[model samples]
Target chain A: MPQITYIEASGQSTTVNVPEGWSLMQGATANGVEGILGECGGSCACATCHCYVDEPWLAKLSAPTEGELEMLENTASERKANSRLACQIKATAALDGMVVHLPESQE
Target chain B: MPMFRFDPYSPLVDADPFPAYKTLRDEHPCFWSEEAGMWILSRYHDIVAAGNDWQTYSSARGNLMTELPGRAGATLGTTDPPRHDRLRGLIQQAFMKRNIESMGDNIRDIARQAAAELKGRKQIEFISDFSSKFTVRVLFAVLGLPMGDEQTVRDKAVLMVQSDPKTRAKGPEHIAAYNWMQDYAAKVIAERRANPTGDMISQFSLAEIDGDKLDEREVLLTTTTLIMAGIESLGGFMSMFALNMVDFTDARRQCVANPALLADAMEESLRYNTSAQRFRRSLQRDVELHGQTMKAGDFVCLAYGAGNRDERQFADPDKYDITRKPRGHLGFGGGVHACLGMAIARLAVRVAFDEFHQVMPEYLRVQEKLDWMPSSTFRSPLKLELSIK
Candidate 1:
């Protein structure tokens, strides 16, 4: 089991055993994390599963494709260096101590 | 409210049946559907009560006809209270009033373009040519999606609301669509990352709740929700609007004569002929609504469309008077989970009515009967052919 830590907007911490092979979006969704709406499901089209990855864990992940780079421009939250779609990021052993912040709104 | 056998799929799909609605509104406050097998609240007050009362009618059971795509346990729609609050808060911050308003000019521009595409055609398949295409374009533009693969996306969305059991059983398409959209959105997000633009995606990428950063899933899901919500809702509104306007030439001309009253027309059209039918809620415990004792976890439906026609709520409720004040119509939904994209929906319709009437005045309706979207969740024309003679 891969240990995944979720930090809420209010600074509360929840560590869950996220199974490998599933995307981070699936992990959060399976655990009933409220912040992720995933309205379009795991499809990167919705961007409801947006997350700001911990800078340290960025290198191990797959670089975003051209299509994804364009969709991120539509999110309500501000664009930043570490911004990544959670659905695109598969939960892997390489990223065990990763932390994510919540956005203000997605509706 | 009752098991009214109205095949919205066949011909006469555009006919206005206010009398039928009034009867249901007066008599059946709450009735059990034998076919749908769910408790439906049709009266206007009852519909409002269900929507307003979150504890009694919960969204945690999910909103889509079946399990939401890629959703395993409880997603945003199926949860209540703190859980819903957390998700709603994030979404609200991104879809603020000012942000949606700022996009009004853009939405109008899209509506004009949609109408433009239908120029000179004698007959047009309203759903495929106009409503689906136009709404898809506008929504993806809002999401900053490239215009390359829009038709495919629209097709996928249409597939979602279909009822035919075999088609409904095909889950792979939806799952495939989810993955494709996630990929598309991710790529779009990356562009803003490299060279940050003024789009919402750029803003979300940089947003911070409490000094921490949003992970990948949050961004993707938010984008997905916006795209899906924007897609169905806009298309649904447009189809219903066209169905009403074409059928009632007088009401159409009234709006054309007074463009400023486009909003009034939209409000009336929605109240009189709402597309979203059941605001489905799952029961939390043993609760008695009207008379029936609803079992815990049973699906309790709030029939907004029926509610709008309820005679108890409005005098002459069966009449489609554009000028009448449609107070408390449950069209855009209610409470915390109320349609947050209403700002955009209103703007879209207001602009659509303004432009539609300007270009295609007195367009003739095609004889082909319209097909209603099959899913129990929503009630919009799947296809409506219109002839501009």
Candidate 2:
């Protein structure tokens, strides 16, 4: 299990052991973590499940697809270069302590 | 020049399009249709790219093949972001998964009552008796419209997209239906304004994006667009799923035995027989694809039906496998302009099948001939009269 840390915009941080292969959005949503709305049920269609990866852990993740990047631009919250759709991020052993910052709004 | 002569509205394709779709995908990935005057994209990758690349393929002109042009900056579906994003985001929460999930009981009850009505009837048209009832009742609940108005709304909504050859030729009649939708939506908006309530209509009336609220016209168009986009397709999809059960008994039995696989069954049905076969998009800029130059303003039909059945994407794409993984399917489309009411649709479908199977677990297909309604965009059985076992 990969231990993932979800930090809310409000500075609240919660750590959960996410099973490998589960999306970050699924993990955060499964544990009732606030600020991640997988409105499309983990489909990359909706950018509601966007999360900002902590800079330190960014190196371990792959680049977002052109579609995902376009979706990031339309997210309710302002997009940073570190921004990513949580559904696109799969939990792996290499990212055990990966930290993700949830946006304040997922509209 | 089109690699192969194909008319989407032709009787053969209208009756069953998979054969045509397969041909289009294999022969001409980006075929130009002289009859329709649009470039047809059939491959999964092409459809996905076209949908995502808003800069290259704009939706501002509208997505309907029969729609009158010059609709830029109009409804959510017909516009590009940041306008599309703002419009969608404003009401997105209203149709969110949590909210739609909350309506599960309402949907289930509607499905149950509709299903129960079939108990004594030896023969029943699934579309009229059951699917329409479930779809319309749920729409009423979601839109905050009066329940008594379900039939009127359903009738008009159906008329708006009534695209059979006869109906297609009746331009004035289609326009009349379109006008009725706008007028009805305007009335609903006025009523919501006079008396605010906790419904999607009221929410749209009160919603603000950047402190700017939707005007009467905008609200009316939005409401009408939502109804136009939602009603028929949802009902059509339900009918398609029911027909699938009759066509695939073993798959149906598997679903009946393990209700959990209902979701997967629905996905397989969606992929196998996508209701919204194709949607149109106008090229934003001149683009070359497969050695053809498609100029800006040229309409392009993103063939979701073909893409869904693309052999490269799904293993044995023609085979309808309920247990197959359902992810990455473009049944509801993709990218920013994806179906807004997807959550609501999914919930309604799951609940509809769950309640329906409980009441009528088994059914038989009486006839081999199904009257598939002719439409350039949508595919539906005109009437699936079933005799319950």
Using TM-score as the measure, the top candidate is 2
Q: Candidate 2: misplaced stretches above 4 Å?
A: A1-83, A86-107, B1-3, B68-72, B164-170
Q: What is the per-residue lDDT of model 2 for residues B350-381, given as tens digits with 9 covering 90 to 100?
A: 88888888877888877789888667888888
lDDT on C-alpha atoms for all candidate structures:
0.66, 0.79
Q: Write the per-residue lDDT of candidate 1 for residues B1-389, one digit (tens) a residue.
A: 54564322222322433444454555555666544556767776566556545676777666654545554223445557655555444445545444678788887898898888877878888878777877887877776767878887776666555444334333666567666766766777788788776666777666654453445766665566556667776788788888888888898888888888777778787788777666578777777766768788887667677777776656776677888746445676554565667667877778876776667876767855665665555677767888786
lDDT of 2: 0.79
Candidate 1 residue-wise lDDT at B239: 86
Relative to the true structure, candidate 1 reaches a TM of 0.69
DockQ for all models: 0.02, 0.09
Backbone clash total, candidate 1 = 83
Interface RMSD, all candidates in order, equals 14.1, 7.8
Q: What are the models' TM-scores?
A: 0.69, 0.81
Worst 10 residues of 2 chain B by lDDT: B162-171
